[model samples]
Target chain A: MSAEVELQNVSIAFGNFYAAKNVNVKIGAGEFFSFLGPSGCGKTTLLRAVSGFLEPSQGKVLIDGQDMSGIGPNKRPTSLIFQNLALFPLMSVADNIAFSLEVRGHDKVQRRKRADELLDLVALNGQGDKKVHELSGGQKQRVAIARALAVEPKVLLLDEPLSALDLKLRQKMRTELRAIQQRVGITFIYITHDQGEALTMSDRVGVMNDGELEQVGSCYDVYEAPCTPFVATFVGENNAFYGKVEKVEGVKVKVQTGGSSFIGQAGLGLDKKNYKFKAGDEVIMFVRPEAISLKGNSKKTQNSFSAEVKTIEFEGNLKNIFLRSAEDVDIRFSVPSSSDTSGMEPSKNVSLSFSQDNAVVLPTGALALD
Target chain B: MNSFYKKNGPVIATFFLVAIIFWLVFLIVIPQLYMLDLSFRPNLPPLLRGGPDDVYTLTHYKHFLYGSETSKDAYNYVDIGVFLDTIITAVLVTIINLCFCYPIAFYIAKLATPNTARLLVLALVIPFWINELLRSFAIRILFAGEGVINNILLELGLISTAVNFIALDIALYTGLTYAYILLMIFPLYNALETLDTNQLEAAKDLGSSTVRTHWRIVIPHAKAGIASGSTMVFMLTAGALATPVVLSSPNTYWFTQLIYQWFNMNDNWSRGSAYSIILLVVSVTFVLLMMRLFKVTIGEVVR
Candidate 1:
């Protein structure tokens, strides 16, 4: 049977400071879940807690519905691939891959056969006898994975395994890792800070901020529909505007900006229950750079603004056009390089518009704008 | 390349080389050569006792190697028994020190916490800096017949007659060992400290228990340290003479005590030089044998 992991209001505090705070997550069997955050945001701490390196101070950790309390790392059915890969440098590749079996007192021939199968699985066939130091960085990465899987662990935990690799190699390994997980049909809990890696490989991504989990959902939901300002800012690029709510409908709210009022979508089923748009209540509106398009005609729409193009920057596939409204409010709009807007002159006033669905209204709280 | 070398020049490097070689000859090589030459000279003959032109002979070396109690030359000053005693004492002291020092060194290096480790290293260095003679005198208090230890034991009713605390060969071994334990431990601790702790953890996580992990991982990593520390202790102990003279009676004289007897007490410089050469050869041979057995480079073991 496959394994499911659950962390029940877990909190890990170091002396007077909390490294992870009340983290609760339920990962289903055979799911490729990822904990995504910037460095020191406790993603690795959470992964370590799952792997039984550090116990939570206030809650229970359950694996496959069994309490993992007081269990040591070696006693757990989880195998972790450390950030440095932690390969046995003195041992040959095959011996390293066969270590778990060898320790369990299996026959040498049996351990060798299993090690060979795992080597072939990781696509390092016929190179098992070579020492770990004799291999390239990418090959060492594969060896680490092979060693972790040789134990036939129900859950595999990887802590930033690709952080040491160059960018091209990292990208290539991401696909290989996902394929290996699918082939094995085991639960893979990955930890990483690079948003691209989290988005590209994880079946579900959990965003962590300040030691607390902000949101957990599919890659698209977490990226396209961020629940808070931190999620919006961290997941992707966005242009923020501070304004006050002017009116409210069933699922739509109208916010008033400098010299302009526009309709936007209301927060939908988000965690903050107090997020109701009463008239004159201050809030912030988030619009992605690509969502807002530059228009030549100055026509009024449900959500539209008139601004001047301050500067234009070419970024290979896209152009970043900085804009400022007549009231001196700054805005940025991104357009595809192939757009005919390349002929537009700088410092000229242009109209910008986007559908209300593309606008996300963030409630005024700790993350509220000035 | 020739132009580059000419610009930076080889004169400075050549000058440094010649200077080092000259210093070595004056300080080390020349003295060693003189010692070798002295080992070959015969003992002073009675006919030239009042003159400087003594005839050279192999009488001293011959007596040292082949003389027996009944042989006429056995009455000569060279006593093979003395050299044999020094070699045996040196070997016994080396073995004893190794047996006691290795475990403590391993614990300090591999097991103690950081604060405890610092304190242990500090504790080891304290006695090391105290004058060796003062340290040996301190050992007298511990082994004194009616000193503090005997007094405490009497109060505890553990023995009678003070137990002759410094009795027999025990005193010599105790004094020499107390003085040399740190020498054996410090090198071993340094070597064990360089070992990567990750190897041990990896071994344990792979399923080997604590004891098995030590045998497979910790022991192998500490092999260089053990070999080096043992060799140093062996060499130093083999050549030690002061402890036997100060702490033991003539019946328990060590090999170096015998070497001293030949050189000074009996005025036999030729035989003493021969004994010194033998000690040097034996120390070098043992070091080489250990290096070969451990399959480690000599540099790794020593450092």
Candidate 2:
């Protein structure tokens, strides 16, 4: 019921502009893989390529080791859930779910039976007789899932299908989607720009930027050890320090920026390049906001700086403290709501520090902000 | 009504209301009521009007079923046959126009680029700027013997003799179809333009072929437009006089030609009015039947 999907040097170009550039990844059978990137970053284009709506201009797409060139969407063994769901408004829920079966010449009884089965699978039992518009937003989402699964496709490709839902429904659907994927044991290729969705639901995440897959790794690995400045800033919130490397020692590099020095681990460059640190290479040091602390001293932390607290934003579970360094560089760090905040006030002087292992130093190329 | 008066002041609202009333009463209702009245009276001589012979009767309506009692069969087969022929031909023309215009409308609305769509619309509309009479005459000349098409075919050695297109009613059908093509196309285009293109891709991705996709999705969604276009084309074609006269051969006849002859040649306005009233009733019934068949409301079609 599941198949391995592999892209080998695939590039899709519209005239002179490449929508997807030389993307290569092998999604194993039954794997829940996700492509995470911002808008216009080629994630949707890559998903379209896999679904056979788009043909790669350069290389091959293989499903179960079968070359998929010249195969149209109708002949492919994959189902695509569009961003807007694209359910047939003229049809009942049963008919919408059974559309694939109907098109394949199945009789009405078989289609209805299979449609009901799929509805039950999606936890929408007995909703088959209702019109598509009669269902709630979340129910419609489930109907789309049921319709896609009715075909029993080897691969299910979703192009930000949950993006239109409200926050709570989206969260609930994410878990349900993960559970359904495991139950069916089919390959699921999900495309989205939300880092939370990718981090929580996907077994492996591919971070894309400017038509290029910048990083492909597990959620934990991508968050903990990003190889490029784009991935570091794009995958999560990070305080980036523009600096020059002062020295290299073992796996750690010391960088000096804004009259302040920090030591962090060296990171690799883009996919194949082995970026080495030296005494004069310009770099960017990234540290997650949660990794920084206000109380740690120089003896306990490797990098220490004094800054003036600008503002303290109290989110329900945590408080985000905005600060301005002595050199006027803006910094932000988060503290748990349970932590003591007696000394933390607006415009008050505070000392902040983070351990070296929590920060990463990489050669700057393209920042996600740019 | 009150809101309209408030929005546009009393003077403007009253003026608009008066103008609409005048137009409806004088232009539409009055003329139709006069014709209905005349249809029930005998076509007596002018001197006999308001005399003993001037009386309301069903004689004019009965004349349609039995034109002249002097014949042996007395069933008025020619008139009835011509009426049925006109109806069947109009239906054929409607079906042909639908088959031709559906793809063109879909292409313009969905497949063509915006620039190409604008150009195509311009091309379709530009020919309609000319009078329909002239367009019908042009089609008549094109399909006539030794016409442009036959001349080309002769030059290419494709035909040994000239084809009698008018005798076959091909010229008439072509003229009628061309005359009302825009009426069919615009409505279909308006409906198809609102269709989300993702639905097409979704159907294809679900393994539906192009034919099945249209049968199951596109056609069902465009039912209102189809009903509207079909009704307009059928009514116009059935009631048409100029196209049939210009494009018909010696062997062809149209029901409107009979009505025209009764009014002008026989000086029998009563019979003409009766025939026209019947045509209107039948056309309205056909429209209602179509609406019922398509499962659409009048509001949907009008919209």
Candidate 3:
């Protein structure tokens, strides 16, 4: 029911620009994997490469250990749910779901039967007779999912399939998509820019930037222990401090920035930085906003800094407090606000602290500016 | 009418209303009413016609369909057969235009690169700038016995003798198909261009081959374009006067030619007007039928 996909040094180019460059990933059978990146970062390009819509400029894609050169998308054991869903507007729900079967010359009875089964699988039973336009957005999403599943593809590729939905619907579909993948037990490769969806649904996430896989790991691995500044900053909200490595003491390295020195775990996770770092080497230290606390000078953590509370954004249960460092570097941290909290006035100094274990020190790479 | 008057103030609105009234009365309404008047009168010789003594009747309409297959009467079975044949030929021409333009439209809309697509658009459009009469004349030259096509075929050893292509209505079919190709392609291109390419890719990814993708998806998405294109091309071809006359021999009798002869050669304005009315009725009916069949509103086609 599932197939392992191995992308060996895949590269896709358009003229002089490589949309995907030297990409390598080994997705396990039935595993839910996600490529998380910003727009135009080549995650979709890599997915197209796996789906055989795009041929790799160099290297090859192997499914279940079989080389797939010269194979087209129709012949490949893969189905792609496009960003727009791309449902056939002319076909009824049943016909759309049974399109794969119908094209293979199956009789109406058999195709309808298969379509009904898929409709049931997507929890859309008996709603197979409606046109695609008649269905609601969420219903259409389910219909698209059912159509892809009806093909019985070994690998299901989703290209930001839920991006068009409302926030609440997108969140709801994330859970539903994961559950559906679990039920079908097929290898699902999802591509998305929304970090929340990727982290919530993927068993392992590959964070990409500029056509390169910055890091590939579990949600916890990507958040708790990012391998690059790009991954650390891009994957989630990270409170960063631009600085140079002051000293490396075994597992701990002290970074000097914003007229303050903070100590964090040295050289990425496992103390293995992608590039070697030494004292006085330029580095960026990243710690999650949630990891930083508002315990002023009385904080016990070794990693602490004083910043002016520039702004406070109250977001439901959490409140984001934007801070300006002594060197004017902006930092942000969020705290749970169950009630109408008392004033933390703007321009008031606040001490933020995080444990050394919760922070990562890596040689600086690309930073997400926007 | 009141809303239109309200939208634009009285002066400008009234001016436009007067302009439209002038157009309707002078160019359309009066001419059509006069033609209707003419259609009900008998076809008399020019010396005897247009006088107060001339009589009004449906004799012209009856004369078109009165005779049986065995009748030895002149104009016997010709009008009905000619009308039917004209419809059939127009349908064939429309079909040929569709077949020829579908791939070109799809290629320009979906497959061609930007530069090549631009070039293709120019190629499809530039010829349409010349007069259609000239284009039809060019087709006549091409299909002539000693023409470029015959010469090429003879030199290539494809045929032993020069094929008399003009003897048949090959000239009309070829000329009409070529003449309205842009009409077919532009609308189809416009429709197919708006299609989400991901839909095609999704079909292919979902186990549909290239042909199946077009059959199930592309064609359906381009339905409005096809409907509009077919309606325009069919109407044009059916009502075409120049192409058939320029390309036809004695044997190639297009319905338009019959109408032309009624008005010019025979000085039968009544029959000519009746035939013109029929052609108008048929084209309008076909347009409506196409719109209904494609489930498109007139607004959709006009758009």
Candidate 4:
């Protein structure tokens, strides 16, 4: 069972402070959506609003074209997997999964049968009789999922449920979660601060900052073409250049910083008319670490700069080269470990350049560092 | 034992151990043993000790079950009725205190803000600062014939005549409930405070109603606290003497009062000790029954 959810100008305020301010988005039925943000950025608040735990102060939450203003969480067709999993420690795995059915007046046999089916769905066969504490961390996570799914909710909301696991288990769970979502074909609204989780699992990602949704787009669009300065820096690592626009040419803009001049394409926007760069406007140019390369090695080099090699970090598949520009700005770029590295040494002068399309220039507002 | 010495050093550890042993022997164990011994002997004069008539027997214990042989009834219904009444009243008091305290404890622990909870706890504790005897007397005055409640009811025309609350045993129940209420509240608050609130939210999010959430989750988690609180309240209410004496009318007869009469008024220490032993056995049985009902061990309740 799946239903579309729409938030129309929803804002939740606690006294004067708005935890979620004017959020508006429609999640497609059966689509896996993720809200990505740092802590206290209102991602969880918005999820709560959809699950009917919180009432929006301003607008409406419409689920399947029905207003859910006065409905409590129990009446809403939504289930939440809490951050801590919140499995009933006093219950066996079967009884924990069967709790919703039990509350709906189902007999013990029916509940047990449904619980067994859900356990099989989660691939935890023969685990129904064990106590919650007897299960491992990953098993507990599955039991929580089965419990949420037993209610047959239309939308399943997850509030960083995998945050407590180790790195390896977390990665494994991510793939399993995506597969499970597709199999059930219900709308899943996942809230997390981890960018890797948001990028890898969600069909579309909503980036939030300080109670406002900065941008909502596909993983490729958010990573390759971020509309705002915050999204570019928050989503991934970026090397930024503080400068003023010197020339505006169609979709390409030239920026001049101290001791260097760079040309990059203008930032993308949902509405192109509202986002434009002009001469003398202050802006920041951002480039991903993998974009920069040695000068004269590629055909599309339009901007170039000289810097000294600072340090090289040898990661498993890639080597990260750090450099300091003539103006003392630190820059970093990565090359595959299999590439030649004979002459790159600390304090050696090197020329670095990137193509225009790989870099984006946007009007500086709020950077993730700030 | 060695850890104790290592933690506290030899001299201090030895001092504490000796003190505990001395208190256990002289204060508790010896008195209980003396009562047990006295309960099995015959009630006699001072000069009869070691004489042929002075001997150990079950006469005093038998006296509790049957009155003098000349009595008409087969069993002593008056004393037995009073004993049963005392037990029923104690159970009722425990039930009433639980019903009153569970919601208050939950509100203080989970629903109310920290400041409001602190203020509520302060309010609950301030009244208990007054002596229990004075509080019981205050309750007696409030429920008396010409008391504040009766006067208000009469003035408002809710009743044409004053109700006999004391004769109806309402005043005694109220006084006992008031006296032992804090014992019930604190244990429940301690248990409920440790409950992770995420569990409650998870239950709600899973489409469980509020009442069902408590039935399946909250009350089950608070079993240890309920057992401990109920056992303490029942025992204390059954053993209470002053509150019943202050609040009861002339018609009311309490089991403790019979024990008091046997020991003091009638100078029959042996019969009083037998009744005391019986009450002790019943209280212990009630505690065991509470443990069984809650499915908790004594260790859990103590914790």
Candidate 5:
């Protein structure tokens, strides 16, 4: 029902300034791909370029192998749901959904029938005669989706459609949006600055910074094995410890910090010679909060450190214990509230350990190493 | 109560009341009441204060609506031609200005680049800084028979004889309406600019072409502006005096030219006051009818 999209080394420029740099991405058919980044990071620009509002300054934007150059937005087999939803306030719900059909010169009866079908598709059956403004926010959101789907566009583009809703409603819409996308079986290209929205719904996400794509991967790779410091800080909360590479043996590298030595796995494609990490070569260790486990009355892993608990953050199901080592290397360890858990008391010394596989040694320059 | 009065409260309220009373007597109520009285009296006798005998007569209105039999010429008689001309000219001017101004307004509102839009708006405003009469005179000079236009035409071999450009009714209408083109554009620009561009994009993304988008999203949203601009252009062109006097030949006259003829040429203030009242009623009626037809509030149209 939907066609795939491909952007091959595409770049967009405004006079001398590049709004989107050489970006290459392939969205396969029926994939819920998301372009995720903060505002002004060129994700929306890239989406607009794909939608034919903006023409790429370099390379090609192809829809299923057909070049989209010189094509206007209306000519494209793509539909975009604006951030404001952009529903026609003057029309009834049915007319708003059947707008594209009317443009295509379909008769009144046929357009109405198609509108009714789309209303049912979005679960607003029998409500097609209601005025657009009469609908609630959620209903308007569904109408926008139904209107976009009425044209049966090969690719549906959604630009921060849920950014205007409250947190709880946004979450509810998230599942509903994903479900609707799945039911329609269209290639949905969603754009959002919210990392949670991307991770929860996307088949894959392309993280953008400035005007360039920083990394493209599945949610797991983007969150865990982030190739750049920007991605590590952006994808989720991460605690970083500065260190020096003391040794590299096989797949593991031992990095020495201020008051102790910690071991972590070296990244895959980083050139070792480029880093030239001899003994005492500066490096940075990136660790996730959940990866650090408290070793209470249990045998520790290959890497363990003694740290005094500085603060306890009670997050309902899980408690995040903030620990400080002798060198004052503050670290966080997430412990779930279980029956066997030894309740962590603040200011108590505890041993927290994580396997080298869980920690990654990122060569210096991308991040500051103390 | 005396203490409160001494605390500047009574003084402030008294001053405000006095100001309102003064405005009512001098600015609004007095002139209108005077005009109403004048509309019922004979021209010469009322000007001479012929006492109670001159008060309360339907003679001026009847004479303006149905001409006097003793008059040798109908043009000399107070006839309904002026009223009809004023309405027809105002309607035509409104239509003409709307056609010329809407596209420019849309470009400034929706499609123009930032700097270019600003420059275009600035260009529109530039001609207004000079006196409007001077501008009209400048147009006259360029088109006059012995002026620059005829000379250029002669040089270019386009015409062998000088053309009398100002000896036409169209010149007066064109000049007067063009003077108020900017006024029509401002309200339209404001309305069109407030429309959501994303709505247009959504329409386009839904397979509507540029024309369809303009009709559905752009025009409907610009209703308030259109209504407002129509009111302004009608009121202005209907009540205009200077353009016709300067540009029109004596054979063909605008309605305001006739009203002035009553007040100044014939010194018939009673007939002029009746014409003024008729003009006011017609303008108000047309505006009300338009508002009702368009389903827009007067406040929305004005603001």
Candidate 6:
């Protein structure tokens, strides 16, 4: 039901501005792949290139080991669900779903029967006679999916299709979308800026920035070990400390920063992914909040530091305690809200600690936000 | 009206409401009533016009359908024929204007760059700044004997003889279509501007060919605009006087030209009022039929 999609140095340019610059990646058949980036990062451009709405300025887009050059969007065996869920408002639900088949010269009976089957598949059964406006936002998305599926496309492309939905429905639809994709067994290329959606739904997530693919890997791999400064900050929240590398020992490096020498597992600090590094290199160590713990969780082998508490953010199950060292270097860690965090108050002093393996030592690069 | 006063207080609200009523009655209602009254009276000479002798009759209306049968002269089939011709031309003009304007409007709204779209709108508008009468005469000059079109065709050897476009109906439509085309383009542009480009892409990705995409998606979404533009163009083309008078040859007449002749040349204000009323009725019917056909509500069409 699905096929492999590959991009070979694909670049899309609008006159002189590069919307997508020299991108290369491979998506497996039946793989749920998502391109994660902020707005204007050219993720949508790359998706459009695959769907045939955009032609790459430099390289090739291939599907199922076949070159897709000179092919129009209609001639390709693919379907795109739009950001706004572009369901046909004028047509009945059945008609909107059956439209792809209708244009293929199918009779009304066959179209109606197929539309009804899809209606049941999308869980909107017996609601085929209603117009698109009569349905809720989630139902409209289902209709759009049903319509796209009616063409029996081997690859399904979605351009931020769930953006218009509210948080509850969006979370709900995320599970539904993954289920539908699995049931259909088609290659799905989803484009969005929300890393939560990309992480939750995609088997593999491609982090894009400034018209470039920063990193492409499994959700856990990218979130756990981001390769670029942009990816580390953009993919999820991480507290960073700027420093210079003091020494490299095997796969670990010790960074001297803000008058404190911190040790970390060396990863992700190079001009290019393949570049090597040495001592005295300027770097930033990024640590996830979950990686740091209160002094109780710190083992004898870990390093610890004392800092004054600045703010306490109480999320339902976890309390985020922001701390600042004597040198004014800021760091934060999340502790289980039930674990006696009552003392974690503003202006209160506390000790934070983490193992060297959890802190990623990378060459200083761009932060997620200015 | 009471709510209006409640909302804004008594004095200013009453003044505004009464002014609106006064304007409607004095400007729109009174003139329409006067025309209706005049239309029911028999046609009389200029000196005997508005006399007490012949009034309150259906004779003028009957004369429009049967062409003054009580007269001691040849049967004037021209009036009734032109009346039908006016309707048919109005419909044809509407259709033609739609065909010409839809693609341009869509391009401007959805395809062209914003600057290009602005320039194209200006292109549609700039010619109208030249007085409409002069534009109509320009059409006549272009299509008349030994005019620009004739000279070009002669030079290209497409035809050895000069084509008298004025005698043909083409000249009148060329002018009227030009006159009313801007009216068609604007509404369609307004409607199409609201369409999401993603919808068009989604249709193509759903395996719809270009024509099918427009047929099932674009046109249905733009029905209100289509209805609005078509009705306006049809009514205007049907009631237009300058094009037929300036561009038509001898023995050719438009319904407006007949109204003009009845009022001015024939010295029959009653018959002319009847003709004007008939044009109004036909125009209203066309508007309502367009609204019905396109499934557009009054508010949607106006919007």
Q: Which tens-of-lDDT digit does each residue in B62-165 have in candidate 5?
A: 77766775776645333466577778878998999999999999998889999999999999999889887887887777767788878999999999998887
Ten residues in sequence with the least summed lDDT for candidate 6 chain A: A268-277
Model 2 root-mean-square deviation: 2.0
Residues A216-290 of candidate 1: C-alpha lDDT, one tens digit per residue: 888998878778787777787777777899998866888888888878776543563425778888887888888
Q: What is the lDDT of residue B274 in candidate 4?
A: 95
Q: List, residue by residue over A1-370, the lDDT tens digit for candidate 5.
A: 8999999999899989898999988999999999988788898999999899999999899998999999999999999998999999988999999999999999999999999999898889999999998988889999999999988899999999998898898999999999999998999999998999999999999888888887788888888787766677678766677888889887678998877888887753322222235577777777888787766434446677888878877788987778788778878777686634455567777777777787877666353122
**What share of the reference contacts survives in each candidate?**
0.31, 0.95, 0.92, 0.87, 0.87, 0.87
Query: How big an interface RMSD has model 6?
Result: 1.0
Kindly give the number of clashing pairs for every candidate.
Answer: 2, 0, 0, 0, 0, 1
Which lDDT values do the candidates have, in the order given?
Answer: 0.80, 0.92, 0.87, 0.92, 0.84, 0.88
What would the per-residue lDDT of candidate 4 be over residues B1-303, giving only the tens digit for each residue? 999999999999999999999999999999999999999888889899668987789887777788667888888888888989899999999999999999999999999999999999998999899988999999999999999999999999999999999999899988999899899999999999999999999999888888989999999999999888888899999999999989987888889999999999999998999999998898889789868876899998888
- Local accuracy of candidate 4 as per-residue lDDT tens digits, A1-370: 8999999999999999999999989899999999999999999999989988899999999999899999999999999999999999999999999999988999999999999999999999999999999999999999999999999999999999999999999999999999999999999999999999999999999999999988988999889889889999999888889899999889889999887889999998855433588899999899999999999889998889998999999998999999999988889999999989778899999988999989999888788863
Supply DockQ values for each candidate. 0.41, 0.87, 0.83, 0.78, 0.78, 0.80
Q: Ten-residue segment with the worst summed lDDT in candidate 1 chain A?
A: A294-303
- Candidate 2 Cα misplacement greater than 4 A, ranges: A270-274, A297-299, B9-15, B45-54, B69-72
Q: B22-125, model 2: which lDDT tens digit per residue?
A: 99999999999999998999898889888998788998777778876676667778888999999999999999999999999999999999999999999999
Candidate 5 lDDT at A203 equals 94
lDDT per residue (tens digit) for residues A1-370 in model 6: 8989999999999999999989999999999999999999999889889999888999999999999988999998889888888887889999999988888899999999999999988899999999899999999999999999999989999999999999999999999999999999999999999999999999999999999998899899789888888899999889898988888887788888888888887775323342245788999888898988877676643757778999988899988888897768888788788878777678988877888888887767787773
TM-score computed on alpha carbons, candidate 1:
0.85
TM match of model 6 to true structure: 0.95
Error of 3 at A172 (Å): 1.5
User: Would candidate 5 be rated incorrect, acceptable, medium or high by CAPRI criteria?
Assistant: medium
Would candidate 2 be rated incorrect, acceptable, medium or high by CAPRI criteria? Answer: high
* Candidate 1 CAPRI assessment class: acceptable
TM-score of each candidate? 0.85, 0.96, 0.94, 0.95, 0.91, 0.95
The candidate 4 chain A region of ten consecutive residues with least summed lDDT is: A268-277
Residues A1-370 of candidate 2: C-alpha lDDT, one tens digit per residue? 9999999999999999998999999999999999999999999999999999899999999999999999999999999999999999999999999999998889999999999899989999999999999999999999999999988999999999999999999999999999999999999999999999999999999999999988899999789888889999999889898999999998789999989999998875555344688998999999999999975634558788899999999998999998989988888899899989889888899988999988889888787873
Which numbered prediction scores highest in DockQ against the true structure? 2
